[model samples]
Every structure is written in C-alpha cells, then in structure tokens.
Target: MSKFKKKTGTSQDIPTSALPDIIFMLLFFFMVTTVLRETDLLVEQKIPAATQLQKLEKKSLVSYLYIGKPKNAALYGTEPRIQANDAIISVDDIFRWVTEEKDKLSEIERDQITISLKVDQEVKMGPITDVQMELREANARKVLYASIKKVDL
Candidate 1:
C-alpha cells in the first residue's frame, strides 16, 4: 500500500522538457492560425470608391501599376495588352508606339481596340492626363486609366 501510495504521489513519468515544447507548439498554432494583411501595390494610396461598382469582366486587357518610394512609373503589360508601368514612357514615346500600332491596323480594327493605362493611385494628374492626350493624338478613340476605370481626358 505504501509503495502504491508513493507511486501515485510522486509520479516521475512525465518529462519536464515537454512543457516548453507543448507551450511553444500552442503558441505556434495560434500564430499560424492568425490572419495577415496582404500587399497589393508598392505604394499605398487611398483611392476613392464608388457606392456601387461593377467588377471588371475582361482580365485580358488588364494592366497593373505600382508607385514605389523613388520612381512613380511602374507598369506591367502582358499579351494583347502591353503593360508598361516600369520606366516612364513620355507622351512622345506613347504617341510613337500608338501611331506605329495604329498604322498596322485597319479602320475597323482600330475601333475594336482601346488603350488603357494602369497608374499608381498616388500618381498625379499631369502624367495620367498627358498619356490620355497622347492617346488622342495617336488616334486611339478610347483611352482609359486602370484605377479610375474611366478615361479622364
């Protein structure tokens, strides 16, 4: 009875090192379960939102722009839509590119295609508007800005 009583009272079965492991595991589990915010762009800008907005249907023509610490022009163009938010392309270059592409296409084809610019939310009106003017000069019927979702020409 004494042996059994002593065995019950002084239990040496449990490992002392396991306490930290269990605590660490629990902490890790909670930390892993916590949600983290994601980064969508280089610079954070508070863009004005609409009350009721329609989602963009065509991802094909979608372009992206990032406003970083130093450079403001960061464009990403892909197939069917050239993404050029990286190095800033001036109005002259824009005009040249559009005109060159326009010269290749027929009048009918021109009507089918439209140029859309995705600018950083913080990017000023000067450049954005300049691109718009350039597009118009190049004879691009419909010019657009990505963040705005509408042309501000």
Candidate 2:
C-alpha cells in the first residue's frame, strides 16, 4: 500500500565454486593411495623361513616360479602344481618358459637373469629337483630360493 513493495521469494542457488577443487583433490588422493596388483596367486604359498637370507638387488632381472597346491583343489587336484606368471604349467614347460623369459631381456642382461623359486613348505623335494634339472638344462645357472626371515623365539 506504501511506496515499498513486499518481497516474498528467496534465492535457491548452491555455491559450486569449490566443486572442481574437491573433485581434483579426491582424484589425487586415489592416485597416490591405490596400489595395482601385479599377479593373482592361483596356488597357496606358505614360504619356508631361512636363517641366512639375501635380498635381490634388481627385481626386473628376476623371474618368479611359484610351486604349491592349487587353491581350487577340486578343479586342479590336491597335488603340488607349478605356476609361472599367471598360468599353471607342467615340469616339462620349465625349459621353454625359461628360454622365452631370457629371450625377452637384452643380450647383455641375459646372463644376469635369476630364477627365483618360491616353493611351498609342504611340497616334496621331487618337484624341486625336477625344476632344478630343467633350469640346468636351460642353462639358467643363477638361481635364488625365496624364503622368509626366520624369527627366533
């Protein structure tokens, strides 16, 4: 009724100036904290403990061989199996596998390649011996046995 009019509507806007900053911060956080898994273990590994252990200097020059019982016993059976990379392979496959792995490296670094055997504690020496024989045949002389540090009680 007077010179001034009555205001009834209010603003409903949300502040989004910090939205991009929040999103970028979240992205950076995940990039820093996330760890990518290299391989999926098909077999159960319970490494044996050793008193005298030496750490490998260059992991890139090492090829890993996992020997243990299959986690899916019903499918792969209860016997100890050999795993190279991701697939389960046989004893005879060791020679071919070693050759292929060595071929992937430079000629100079070929001799420096180390074969690391990660065998389960319960597995018998028969499989280990077979693997060693195959490695010898392949001329991959440098071998390293993977083991945990023995903790004295």
Q: How would you encode candidate 1's per-residue C-alpha lDDT over 1-153 as one tens digit per residue?
A: 355443456656866888999999999999999976432343334444334445566543333333222322344232111224334344567767666555566666655455655444555666566667766776676654444334345
Model 1 ranges with Cα > 4 A deviation: 1-88, 103-107, 148-153
**lDDT for each residue of candidate 2 in 37-98, tens digit (9 for 90 to 100):** 76788999999999998878898899999999999999899999999989899999999999
TM-score per candidate, in order?
Answer: 0.42, 0.79
Q: What are the per-model C-alpha RMSD values against the true structure?
A: 11.1, 4.8
Predictions in order: lDDT? 0.51, 0.94
Minimum summed lDDT over a 10-residue window in model 1 is located at 76-85
As for model 2, its CA RMSD to the true structure in angstroms is 4.8
In angstroms, the error of model 2 at 132 is 0.3
